[model samples]
Target: MGLSGESQAAYHYTTTRCEWEFYIIVTHTSGPTGRRVLSDKHKERRVGDSREMVELITSNPSALGSLVTCDESWIYCYDPETKRQSSQWKQFDFPQTQKGQAEPELFKSGRWHLHQDNAPVHSSILVTNYLTEMGVKAVPHPPYSPDLVPCNFWLFLKLKENLRGSRFEDIEEMKEAVTRVLDIFTLEDYEGACKKWLECYNKCTEVGGSYCKGN
Candidate 1:
């Protein structure tokens, strides 16, 4: 879901051809020890490429604090290590929409910050002003680097796996299912996931993106 307009169109033409929708913001928390692992569902989608999966698992947040990440399709925050509160899930309709219009109180925590690649929506004046007014620090991230954010490769895979082998009767049902699955995460799980990133980072530094696995 994180693509520039041109790349997005190209991606659509080459990939499944599904039109990008709302923006999803996901945040994960780690345990006190900072050790976590991806859920069973996450592992399923990552069966083929351990290296890529590990890179996706690196963007682990601390248990005491929170992490914020988003894309054009959805905006959400979660503690990868802990069960998130129901109020944390937020769905945005469009980039032009007002900030905090859907759920003002969610951003009221004021303790959180956002790290996102500079996408058109993310860099938009309206979005920037809205995030500023909401007391969220939006930090710039490197482009074309999903490995920098563990969730892009790890948590997203888990989310997709959780939705597999099942049919959602409707969109509402799917949303409810997402909430239910997210509620079961714990800090320990997130730390396990973070280890994957460390493995990937070491591998890349040592062998230039060559294959490396943490046995």
Candidate 2:
């Protein structure tokens, strides 16, 4: 019922693949999720040249939609934009399609909320005020608590586990593997991740905002 984004490194060399940045929002099975990709620039050696590849990927509307879940909610990649434009897009254009869907409870725009970490880009005054004006609620995230975040606790861990020690001939091959993993992720998998997320949140709170030590 909420949206959030995170970055993961897709390695290029050494037979493994980790990219620079990937942003995702986790929600109920039938809701829209937003994803953003950022290029990884490294000083040592290049992982993969994503500039051209990204340009092509972003240009295709289908590419964006393909990132969605089984419910067919559209996921898009956005470029850097002015705060005003970003606000307008999020408030108006983003939720336009879901205006009348009634079959799935989660697809109802009224039930959707946004959850993201306290990064400056997400927590800026302009962004906060815009969300407030648009009536989008945000899920509170405690600082430095990755264990409580769905992507960190569930998505990324599972993703990396699947990618671990595997060799990819090229960036495209690596990407295909990543896509395969996502494509096969079942609704039950997403639900289980969210379930564990709630458990972790409760665990963190029970420890009085300190690290949750196992019982």
Please give the range of 10 consecutive residues that has the lowest summed lDDT in model 1.
Answer: 10-19
Give candidate 2's TM-score.
Answer: 0.47
Reference-based lDDT, residue 83, model 1: 40
Model 1 CA deviation exceeding 4 Å by range: 1-64, 72-109, 195-215
Error of 1 at 182 (Å): 1.8
The alpha-carbon deviation from the true structure for residue 75 of candidate 2, after best TM-score superposition, in angstroms, is: 20
- Collision pairs in model 2: 9-18, 9-19, 10-18, 10-19, 11-17, 11-18
